[model samples]
Target chain A: MSGAGVRFDGEAPAAGEEPQSTATLAAVAEAAGVSASTVSKVLNGRSDVSPATRARVQDLLREHGYRRRGGGARQSPLLDLVFHELGSAWAMEVIRGVENVAREERLGVVLSESAGRLTPGQTWVEDVLARRPAGVILVLSDLSADQRAQFTGRGIPFVVLDPAGDLAEDVPSIGATNWQGGLAATRHLVGLGHRRIAVVGGPPTMMCSRARIDGYRAALGVAGLPVDPGLIREGDFHHEAGYAAGRELLALSDRPTAVFTGNDLQALGLYEAARELGLRIPEDLSVVGFDDLPVARWIGPPLTTVRQPLTEMAEAAARLVLDLGRGNAPVTRRVELATSLVTRSSTAPPPGS
Target chain B: MSGAGVRFDGEAPAAGEEPQSTATLAAVAEAAGVSASTVSKVLNGRSDVSPATRARVQDLLREHGYRRRGGGARQSPLLDLVFHELGSAWAMEVIRGVENVAREERLGVVLSESAGRLTPGQTWVEDVLARRPAGVILVLSDLSADQRAQFTGRGIPFVVLDPAGDLAEDVPSIGATNWQGGLAATRHLVGLGHRRIAVVGGPPTMMCSRARIDGYRAALGVAGLPVDPGLIREGDFHHEAGYAAGRELLALSDRPTAVFTGNDLQALGLYEAARELGLRIPEDLSVVGFDDLPVARWIGPPLTTVRQPLTEMAEAAARLVLDLGRGNAPVTRRVELATSLVTRSSTAPPPGS
Candidate 1:
């Protein structure tokens, strides 16, 4: 037991598998007949190398399945962007927009959801802090006032996505103009010459749902129309609730000629309910939605709805996080991205107009 | 400016908020009119402090929003669990299962997503790793083999929820046995006196699709029934694809007496397509599905399906990550859980039985 070293490298801690015994960089350099640093440059594809030499090195590495490590730390002067999970196609559109800017900046991204819904005794903040991540993009899913304060107080440099705060003003955030989204949907219906326009919205407590209702009323006011109480329906953000609300609205003595739903999923339900009642979209009743989720274009008659600038929000969130990570002070300003009105087959002038 | 010494025993940074500046354990202790260590013990929920003392400390901290800085060399014990975006409900279910164990262990969690789909040149791993989380949970949608190997090589403790790995033997993974889920679904129909059962499945590249096909074959073998290649159909994991596949399968001269689909979403498509063809479920034909997603029980003529045990898988994944984090040299085992058949009105004895 003289002082000979016992190596604790890639050998087993009694693990039964032998598959992990791959060639290391040191071993490869020895066999390839080149210095370690020289081998590194060739493997990373960083600088000039003769074509024959590069091929020879790569072939040798391939023979032993040698993987070069530690290259991911190159530190591309780019932002690390992230997003909370939203939807399939809806998320993709936002990514497409963000990629254009990120490519220009040579930035990397890690799009991810914040921890699940804010509940008592559960928050991902502590763990997120441990990661020493450059900056954070937190998509707040209805956290309580206290939770918001705690998150903001930590001062990790973050931008809140799709959220509204009852917390004190120091927190940073970015979001689409949801109130305006509601207004646009209602105005589109009014432009179609419809008077009895009903609204199917999401949870009453959600900020987006409330803002949408405000916008809907504003558009109705602009058209010189009074809001009808019976035409309004509160819904959860899902297809089933949208269907139920549609059935209720369609059955009223004063049925609406048009209906505006809070999101595409709810709008899909509205479509189902209309079908059951033997109503054709736009022909018998006009339907418009908010957030214009991806499937809105592919399903049934393309839906006429307001589009949230998801990609812009993502890019903005990334930029804001970068600013925070750079030791700059928190940006107290809240960013508001514009939404567009997409006209499709789901809307038209009311029948007999 | 000669010899103007600066001593930073408890020196503050440029927090620049209140006149007192930085918000930290000491600052909160000063504001609360208590000792700093006392404040720390109270905030961390130590039991030695009197209840009255703890309450007083908590009340003062809450009154003036104070947060202690993390990342102070102790390192974060919190784990980051990432998933792809879809509906909040699905992610919530998995979280429920994972949190049940994580919280009990006093380990905090960080959440993230890979956005919708993988985009070219987006280093999602960078964004996630930047947090320097203790470990990671990749709730992968679909991953290429190279991607899986990259993490394995880094020695980062990770577990895949649903992997697309030919290297399953070498990776630490936990998922429902899809083929067994499929066989359970198919056998349910045969138990109800069904014959000529047809299948509607998602992209063949998906691991679950392959597992389901294996199950379908195994069930038929046990029943002593001849395998009919003509009865099989391919589909994407979407409602529309299921609808189209259902219609096409029904059009065959020797139409199936029952149907089996890869997922609840696809089964929903089959439901609509069957309605369009004027077919009554469990009357003209019986239908069964896999994945037993939330919507499976809510729709009309509620669906019968094979449940994938998502909850169990999430819990197991969390446990595995924790074990690895503890520096235990554990073997990478593919832990497979069981699936069950959920009976509902959508299935019955095939017609003319």
Candidate 2:
């Protein structure tokens, strides 16, 4: 049973169990009542079989458990990276870029994810290592500190995507310039001459959120504006949290005229809150967000946010991983990309006096 | 030098290789001039490190070539699995789900990809067994028939997704009930009173295309409409192909009032073509597409498409791979999932009469 991310611990085929052929092509064709050519195509990965015939042949093969050769002989790749929660395919965008570099280096990535809450954690790393995968990429965000260390301590070559902490250098790390992006967003709002500016972001402890806060502070300092910490609030980096933050800010006596959010998903929540409060965009409040994900364009008025090249980031990380597999030494490189604020209909000068 | 996706071959360690001490918590703490708890917290993947300190520690460790484990253990997971043309984390959708299943079943996947047409027929399969991955996923489409057969025949326990032809029973296969899905799409158009219907499909030789064409024919038969060969056309399942098909169909004297495309990517192409030709969606000509991907909803006039639960389908495929890995009989299970027809602004009773 070969699964996408499953790893086997047995030896490659010892000096023994070298040659085993279970069924002949002629036999499978005869049993399935198909011609040799038809069987040959089906067996070859050729797509010329009728659905009925395909189904019948597949049935026969499955029932008889007929394997032409009893042993495998292909040389497997050096690394496999399986990510979890890649549902929307957004996660894949990065891996795509990463795979290109990995291929050149002869590293293989078995892309797969862990189940809900039953994360691949320790067991996953151990199993993958046994297969002798040179390194691993955890498309992760919420791993506890201990688990990360355990994997690192186990001597597994691994990197975490959007990790919750700054792991050791032996483990390469790549992420967006959240702080710069935050500053860009705040500057965009401040440029509109808004005095009462509010900031909504994810939990304060998250590095991303902290970086955004730093950017917000920098933008304020550059603007000669006094930073009122009271205007800053934290959410869960989710739409609902954004909505709550939006509502709270809007209800304040000295309500903020402009707001900067940490992520697009959070920006969406603000949009909903505005609608709920009977407030129109731009006319009532100017908003900006970060991580211009694909859906950013679909939200009402098309969000004006800072962009993060997620694919590039993923690719860069993948390249680093592949380089590690190739026995190339990587420096402790922390790249902070430039962030640009995309202006859209969602932001405009604060409405009348 | 270890990186993501590296594999350990259990080869004998080189002579005179001295055992090295893993960076202990105390050492890292002393090296960084921080408290043991602080280093411990950082190493354990906890959240409390100040940005400055964290970055400093991480950088220092990398500069020193820190290895978390002393050299006794064998190097872990060196095997890699290369997929074909799966750009972005988009392909990871399958990988993640597959990984989850594989992890549970104690397997590891090494992800990789092929360039242009550089795959070495079935020779790669031989290489895979030699490297000793318990199983493989072929990714099905990227490999040739010979390669697929080589891997499968060798009992590598591969579960082929979107198999071109039929296989015997013991080999696992997973894909959508494409024929039924196609039928549903055609029926929707017919019920909408579209008589002069057209078809835009991928390579007709592909099973998915054939199933949809069959469904379209079935709907026409039920509607008592004769199939016009000229109104039907084949495509390469690309945007360009769909655009060409749409252009050709629209030029016909008896233009199709509605068209059903085989794939979402192609459907998007058809949409672009219709717009270029100034043919309004439902207002000018009805266009329905298959594979209701996320992009469908963002179009100016949201596309009317057949929604294939791609994520769910991926999950199912992943599960099948894991099940097979667990020594479950290789079952020829054809999970026929029902596709839903999503109606939006794109489809309407074809332009007047």
User: Which model scores highest in lDDT?
Assistant: 1
Model 2 lDDT, residue B264, Cα: 67
For candidate 1, the TM-score of chain A alone relative to the native chain A? 0.69
Model 1: lDDT to the true structure: 0.64
Every model's TM-score: 0.61, 0.63
Write down the TM-score for model 1.
0.61
How close is chain B to the truth by TM-score, in each candidate?
A: 0.72, 0.70
lDDT of 2 by residue, A1-353 (tens): 33333333333222212133224545667898998677544433334477577566655654655443311122234545555455444466667766665555544556656653324654554444334355566665434444443333223446666644555554467777888888888888888888788898777656778888889999999999999988999977666788899889888888888889887767777877887788878889888988777556544566799987877777777766656545467775455455678888889888785
Predictions in order: chain A TM-score: 0.69, 0.71
Lowest-lDDT window of 10 residues in candidate 2 chain B? B70-79
Tens-place lDDT per residue, model 1, B1-353, is: 11112111121122223333235556667866778777655543345567577667666665665533321222234556666653334465576566666555544455545665622112455443333344677675534443443233223467777664343466678888888888888888778887788887777766768889889888988998878988888877777788889889988899998989888777777877777788888799788877776656655567798988887788888888767655565565567788888998889898877
Best by TM-score: 2
